[model samples]
Target: MSDAQSLWHLADGRALTLAGAAEARRLAVSRGRVWLTLSGTTDRPAEDCWLEAGEAVALAPGQTAVLEGWPAAEFELLVPPCSAAPGRGGLLGRRLFGG
Candidate 1:
């Protein structure tokens, strides 16, 4: 099995802007609740998804998604886990995710 990874954290009303790849991004909440807004593209419309404690959500790649906390929340991104090689979208992997 691959090792686990951490994505980002949020406090009440806080939000994080993230980029996803062609593969869906797997987001798992560790505490509290979170809401997601998937941005629309020329091909697709926007969408919203909600997740509570112990719940998770998957987001399609190729665009940015917004993650906001209900009150307080901790989450981990499953897909496209941190990699040594920089992927599409950004190159500041270590700066954004961690080493």
Candidate 2:
């Protein structure tokens, strides 16, 4: 996993921008639903998939997705080469649950 990172929490009716040529590897949603808008492409609705109470999506290298209409949604951003490993639980499990 690379050390690069970006994180954001968006609210309803709000939109976050992803600069052109920017590359994001993973996005973990911690809260509400969000819409994704790719650069040079039309904005589209993206369902908020729940992994845990505070975990959502994880992308691979060169994968990019914008967020919109994510009211009160917490998201942890991970950049290329720094992908989340499989089989390992989430922060809550490792922290409170003691995975």
Candidate 3:
């Protein structure tokens, strides 16, 4: 895992929407469960599903996803290293480099 892979926590019953990403993303649940709605495009139909801990979904660049925490959840939005911003350092980097 890369240092840029940060974790997100959501309380049960809470929901969040992710959209307009510059690049594709992989949403992975680390703990608990989540309900997700993936917006449809001309070529693909919209999708609704449940993701348990250790499951993941691949989201396109322009796709939209609505995620609701199921009895609380923790997840990570994984972006490709090539897609990450250059010269940007994250928490792990800051801790390791002491910068």
Candidate 4:
């Protein structure tokens, strides 16, 4: 994330629902451990993966997934850069537009 503080924060037994797992490029567990479960799609059944703190994983496009903080966790997600980010518009936007 551009701003590290914006990282996803979760409590014990809490979960973060991700809608565009397909568009997601990477997931990083910054604190504690988490269970990442990919939802079933047309061609495949659901799959689950685990990540401890400091671990990062690549994600396949076009999938849905649920991230859970089994016992408390914090994580960050990196998606493909957008044409225009909400604030600085990302590196590309800033370079092209000249903020």
Best candidate per lDDT, number? Answer: 3
TM-scores for every candidate against the unseen true structure? 0.65, 0.46, 0.80, 0.66
Off by over 4 Å in 2: 1-3, 22-24, 39-64, 82-99
Task: Write the residue-wise lDDT of candidate 2 on 1-99 in tens digits.
Answer: 233556677877887765443443556666676666543334333333324335555443344456774455667766543233433445643564344
Q: For residues 11-56, could you state the per-residue lDDT of candidate 1 as single tens digits?
A: 8877898876666567788888888888886777998988887897
The root-mean-square deviation over C-alpha atoms between each candidate and the true structure, in angstroms, is 7.5, 9.6, 5.2, 4.2
Return the candidate ranking by TM-score, descending. Answer: 3, 4, 1, 2
Model 3, CA-based lDDT: 0.85
Q: Pick the candidate with the highest TM-score.
A: 3
lDDT for each residue of candidate 3 in 1-99, tens digit (9 for 90 to 100): 563587999898999998858787899999999999999867789999999999999888888999998899999988866566755656665565554
Tell me which of candidates 1 and 3 scores higher on TM-score: 3
Q: Cα RMSD for candidate 3?
A: 5.2
The residue pairs found clashing in candidate 4 are 22-61, 22-62
Local distance difference test values of all predictions, in order: 0.73, 0.53, 0.85, 0.73
State which candidate, 1 or 2, has the greater lDDT: 1
Report lDDT (Cα) of residue 34, candidate 1: 87
Model 4 has an lDDT value of 0.73
How well is each residue in 1-99 modelled by candidate 4, as lDDT tens digits? 443224888899888887754344677899999999987767678889999999987666667668989799998876655422456565665676564
